[model samples]
Target: MLDPISILNLIDDVMYFPILIIVMAIAGLYFTFKTRGVQIRLFGESLRILLEPPDKEGAVSSLQAMLVSTASRVGTGNIIGVSTAICLGGPGACFWMWLMCIIGASSAFIESTLAQIYKQKDHKGHAYGGPAYYIEHGLSKPKLAVLFCIFLILTYAVGFNMLCSFNLQSTFIDYSFYNPTTTPVIIGAILAILTGYCLLGGGKRIIKITSTVVPFMGISYVIIALIVIIFNIYYVPSMFELILKDAFDFTSIFGGLAGSCMVYGIKRGLFSNEAGVGSAPNASASANVSHPAKQGLVQTLSVYIDTLLLCTATALMCLSTGIPITPAVSGAPYVQNAIGSVFGPIGPIFITVAMVLFAFTTLIGNLYYVDNALIFLNGKTKPSEKFMRIFHVCCAFIVFIGATISMDAAWAMADITMGGMTLINLPVCMLLGKIAIDCLKDYEKQRKMGQEPVFKAESIGFEKGELDFWD
Candidate 1:
């Protein structure tokens, strides 16, 4: 029998692509106009919040929340997905990708603001909230909230995060010394060890890990890309022309180009930033702050950091370096080749190890997201938490499948699933956005009256509530 996944891929290409992309783009566009460029105006404010997140009351510091969210946001989409777009869509894909970031940033910010507004303390007194909570709390639809949580548990935790583990382990095998079949076994063992360590400390530990590792890998990739870019500095001018040519050249001369490339660029950009997908909001809800808009703005600014800054950096490094980007063998190796062309084999190897690191952090971060959704259902079972560790183990072993599967198809299907999730999330954000604005105004009003900012934790913390570890 044909692979069950193969059947799913066929269905995705035929059905998922058309319906999802159009809807996400339209929603993004609508939010963009409605917000009147919060992404632009609040960009500086977002950075300020990130650099100095208040730490007295919220579940986590604002910076930690942003980092955990970014750890997830910045993964495969930045490194591999950027190359995939350039390969399939050509040089011009970068422009469309930029467009997507502008809008997606707005979407993420709005989603985050809403999440902050609807945040609540769980039975254990941990602050818990997200798109699901907002859907139920803000809209007064608890049934829909449960549905949202279930979808998230399936899409983000079990499916997307597990898929990331597959990316990480397989990349190590595919690009390194280990054989593909054997690598996952080794990787799986390591992941089991690491997962146990990280989960023991919880989201705070995961953020601490990713916050350090992610920026290092991203900077290293840029450094390597820069080495290649310097060698081909003369080719830089033509890159803009090439990108425009592919993006706008509508002729059959372009062979289903233009629209095709634009779609891919936008699709990949959306996938990378994940603003409308509602994943980032879960992270946002964790921030300890009185002003909901503070985290909203910070989360929104992350799309710029992830896509516009980081992803664009990858694209420029590849395309401007004048390496002949081929469609057939697309991925980090292509990015590696673009750099290695100048730096030699070391470039690819550097990318190889770095991607493994980046993917690994994402694997950890996405699992945290998955854990959050699962908590919503099973209500934070020590048993459920233990079970979730196995959830990631299965994902780690699934890494081997990466070697056999076509990366393009794997990513394309991810895009489709991601798009569907975005559609569910976007309308909720738009409708609930007014709530965030009101919350922002309320916080501002409090600030004007010289009230100290406080959140669920400080207001009803175990200390004030007469609760303890046993209680």
Candidate 2:
């Protein structure tokens, strides 16, 4: 008989393999072709628009919105998750992860573009939208939108937050004073309290916090990774060869597709960058941009930063160290040890500090998405302030519970819920993809005409009343 954890893993596998993988690959390729490779072609434009100030003084800037999404994307998954992928899937996992990001960036463009096109305004005149908003407003499918919201809330607020909590606490396991039974509880409580205080301050607080913390931690971690790589520069060529060799190892792929590097690579990539998983679109929608495609392009850049830059840093730091990739040292321990070997005692301490910042920002950023989901679930009305307070407390409690759970169970729950979100979001994005493509065309036409691109719903055959913002 299968236990609960086994059942969860089984469901995750069934969801991801064959069905999820095929859908994601097809959708990514389809969008890449349809957009004429927007992720690549508009790369420079994304950078330019990223620096544009918000039209209004207090509104969220494109860079701020990207940072919010980046805070979520560049968390434990970049470090511990990358380590786990290498340990379980071999050096080849890095190759697949890079490939996945390239393909998935197109999907990110479509979904985030759709979010901007279909975004709604709250009573306070703040923009808020995501997969649920676009699904309802763009597709005119209210029921399906609510379903997406439920799945999103479950995935981000509960499952992913739990995994973040577990990953953070796991870092303390190697310390001399660490106690398995008592340490987790104490750490969980402290984390929960800190998170609860932040959550009560609302979305602006999340934006402020992420925009400040993400850049510092991300740049610092990448710099350290570069130092480690430089110290082991001789191993670079062989590392590349191993990655390529393992990525296409047809023998092992045919033997057990589930255990292959491709599977783990894609899983970790999806979990880390969240390009098409529909989470980033919530942040993308909040950006006060002149054209929807601008935010879309910025988000595409975000995927590259998350997977190509940060995750690659973690992978090379570990693999280039010539450390043995084994199941026993998978996840956080592997990363800590890899760094510890390079910098001695200071290495592990740096990792622990990095994880704390990464995981804490992730917790708040994930809740930011949940705020959008909850708003949509409440019939496009913001939930009462009292209700929000209660929800925040409940979320903090979930974090505590997550910290005390087994790693397997936490990850299993996250994978299944995340898969559920992807299954709904991808097909919906495919249906509404044409609008985003047209928006891109309109933006480019204006750009070529030497004019700043500003969106108007009527210009794209969307009736004035059809949209909440652009109209």
Candidate 3:
């Protein structure tokens, strides 16, 4: 009889493999065309507006939203997930990863634009929205919205948290001086305390924390990776050649196994940037921007930063160091070994610091996503402080347990939920793509007219005041 993990793996193989891949590719291309390649055409505007201060009084700046979401995207997935893709799929997987990011940027723009279009103002005057809000309000399908929220909470908030916790614990324990048993427990306790403190303050606090941490941590890691890459500058051309060749080469690094390249590329790419999977929209909806399309454009840049910049940095480091790609030496350990080969004694220590920051920020960012889901389920009523406190405590406990558990089971559970969540999100984004397209058109028109763009639901055929905050 198949155990639970085996069952989940089988279901994932059947459900997520070609179906999700094809759908995501189609959705990305369709959104790109529908919006006239907004991700590329408006690239300068996205960066320009990203630097603009928070204009609206109630919501976080678009930059804050991007950073918070980036905090989640740039986690163990970039480090460990990239390594897994190379180990299973070969160096060519990096090319596919880049392809997914470029194509999927359009999907990010569409969903994020729709998220802002349909966003609601809580009683406290703070904004919150995501696929759930847009699905119900934009599509008038509350049941499907509820189902999406459930899957999102399960996949991101709980399942992915466990996976991150386990990764963080294992990396530290492997490198630390203490006994593995006691070290994990101590780490778990510290994680719980720190996470609990952040969670207690709610969304505003999370934005503040992530905005500060994301840039510092991201730049620091990239700097380290760049140093390694510069040292191996001569190998740069060969690395690029191998990646491109292996991507299309029929024989593969392991004879006739080239197909795994596409599979792992798409899988790890989705895990890394989270472009069409509907997660970033949750954070994007919280931004206060002159136009909904502004946040959308900002989010499109995030996919590039995550996969093209950070994940690529990790891949180049490993490939440049000539780390043997073997199953026995993969994931975080593979990254550690590569860094160790470059910098010697400081390698594991550097990775430990990087993983801790990456994983911790992911934990907080994920908690915000789940918090929005809980808010949706609880209706428009403001959750009492006590209820939120209980929720925070539960999150802390999950982090603690996650730090101590077996990662195989944790990741299996995450894959099941991630696949289910994507299945729900992809169809909904396609259904609602028109609204975002129209909003992008409106934004462009206003920009060309030398006016700052403002959105009205009525402009898109919605009844006046249909949106909570937008006119």
Candidate 4:
């Protein structure tokens, strides 16, 4: 009989490969066509809106919201996950990852646009919404909305956060002082304590931290990647050739279809960018933009930043080093070795610090989404302060448990929950995508007329009181 971990992996493969992959591809294509490829046509607008100030001083701005979502999107999946994909699936996986990001960005635009359309404001005038809010109001499926929130909590808080903790601790294995038994325990305790401190400070703290850390870590990592690439400049052309050749190797793709480059690429790409996975929409919905589509457009840029920039940086950094990418060197070790090949001991140390920053921000950014879900679950009101405190403690405990658990278990759990969220969110986005497209058209019309795009629910046929914010 297969062991529990093996079984979990099997289920994850079955869930993603033919089922979720097909659904995601179709949804991505559908949205791209329906929105007339808004992700591409309005790419400049996304950048423009990123600098626009929020209507109120205290509200979340477009840039801050994108950073929050980017915090969750650009985590261990960019480094460890990309290394694993290249090792298991070959350099061709990078090609598929790039393809998925370009296509999947359209889906990101749709879901986040819908989120802004259906967002609700708290008593403090803070805006919040997500897949659940849109499903409830736009689709009028309250039960299904609640179910989506349940899945969000499971996926973000329990599954993804655990995986982050585990990935962070796994980096310590390379150090001479690392004791498998004690190191994980020590790392877990420290991570949990830091996470608790941030979580207790609430949403603003999460946003503040992510906004500060994400830019610095992202820029620093990219700079390191550029240096690695520059050092291996002679191999750059051949590396590109290898990636393209492997990507289209029909025999390899069919022979081991489940383990092919396409499968791992799409899987890791989805996990990394979260373009259609419904997670980023929670952060996207929080932005106080003049038009719903402004935040949506801003979010599309985030997908590129995560996959096209960050994930690609990691993939090329590893592939250019000419390292043997066997399964044994699949995750952090491969990245460490690749960077170490260029910069020696300091390379591994830098990656460890990168992983720490990546995973820590991901933990808190993920909890921000969990906080939104918890409020929705509690009748769209804030949970009791005591209950929230208890919840944060439990979250910290899960982070601790995650660090000590088997990596296979951590990944499998995250994949399953993430897959569930994608399956639920994608179909719903397709069904309600027309509203988002209409919103986009309105925004475009205003822009063409040299006026700022302002959204009113009635412009898209939504009635008075149909939406909490726009109406």
User: TM-score per candidate, in order?
Assistant: 0.83, 0.96, 0.92, 0.96
* Candidate 4 residue-wise lDDT, 53-172, digit = tens: 998888899999998888778899999999988989888999999999999999999999999999888878889899999999889999998989899999988999999999999888
Give the per-residue Cα lDDT of candidate 1 at 211. Answer: 60
Whole-structure CA lDDT of model 1: 0.69
User: How accurate locally, in lDDT, is each candidate?
Assistant: 0.69, 0.89, 0.83, 0.91
Tens digits of per-residue lDDT for model 3, 1-471:
998767766666666566778888889899888887888888999999899777766559999999878777889988888888898778888988888888899999988988998888877777889999889988899999999989998887788898888888777645647576788788888888888887877456655665676678788889989988888889889888988988887655346332377667877888888887789999998888878999999999999999999999999999987778996666778888888887997988889888887888888878778878887888855578899899888988888888887655776677678877778777788998888888888888888999988877787777876787786
How high is the lDDT of residue 71 in model 1? 79
Residue 113 lDDT in model 4?
A: 92
Tell me the tens digit of each residue's lDDT in model 1 across 28-101.
77766766677786576678777774556555877888877887888877878888778876777788888878
Candidate 4 stretches with Cα past 4 Å from truth are 200-214
Of the candidates numbered 1 and 4, which has the greater lDDT value?
4
Clashes of each: 4, 0, 0, 0
Please tell me which predicted candidate would have the highest lDDT against the true structure: 4
Worst 10 residues of 1 by lDDT: 461-470
lDDT value, candidate 3, whole model:
0.83
- Cα deviation of 264, candidate 1, in Å: 1.4
lDDT of 2 at 34: 96
Residue 343 lDDT in candidate 1: 78
